[model samples]
Target: MRTEEIVAKALEKIGNDRYLLSNLVFSRVKQLCAGAKPLVDMDLKHNKLSDIAMKEIAEGKISIDRIDEKNL
Candidate 1:
């Protein structure tokens, strides 16, 4: 799916709050950069970590816990 479509679906799963979504994506990207595996399988050579993270969130392969954010 296209990045925009993936992001739209992610918003549906996460909520319409763009700021929270951005933070989630940023956090997931950091984890990806830190050597965490991609939750959604995709060609890493072509997709950016941020895109993969969004896709994972959209597909329900990843989830965010608001309560846990306090410690991060």
Candidate 2:
């Protein structure tokens, strides 16, 4: 799907809160950059880490609660 569509879906997954979405995406991207395994199946070599993070959120593979738990 298109980037816009993926972003919209990811926003929906997080109750349409852009702030929360941004935070989640940022955290996930950081983890990805730090060598953390992606939660979703995708081409890591070709796709950007931020895009992969959003895809994980859009597909319900990542969520605010999960992030919170990890942080805690």
Candidate 3:
């Protein structure tokens, strides 16, 4: 629905899933491959995320629930 919502969802699950891997439709958006592994790693290490999924989330290409934070 909104970037805030997407980020909210990511953060909601951050505690339980520091890796931020859950849900289906957009699992690929969260999944990490060789080229994308750094992205996920950096997202977690930097405590942020790329906007590649921004449009998807905004456009409802992906669905999110909530977010949380972890100590890491």
What do the candidate models score in CA lDDT, each in turn? 0.80, 0.91, 0.40
The C-alpha stretches of model 2 lying farther than 4 A from their native spots are none
lDDT of 1 by residue, 1-72 (tens): 777898899999887778878888888888878777786778778888988889888997777883155244
- Per-candidate TM equals 0.84, 0.90, 0.28
Q: Determine the backbone clash count of candidate 2.
A: 0
Query: What is the TM-score of candidate 2?
Result: 0.90
User: What lDDT is obtained when candidate 1 is compared to the true structure?
Assistant: 0.80
Counting clashing residue pairs in each candidate, in order, gives: 0, 0, 7
Per residue, candidate 2 scores C-alpha lDDT tens digits across 1-72 of 999999999999999999999999998888888888988888889899999999999999999888887672
RMSD of 2: 1.3
Please give the TM-score that candidate 3 achieves against the real structure: 0.28
Lowest summed lDDT across 10 adjacent residues in model 3 is found at: 63-72
Residue 66 error for model 2, in Å?
Answer: 0.9
Which candidate leads in lDDT? 2
Q: Write one digit per residue (lDDT tens) for candidate 3, span 1-72.
A: 466776566545434353443343245344422134332212534433355443333344334442112111
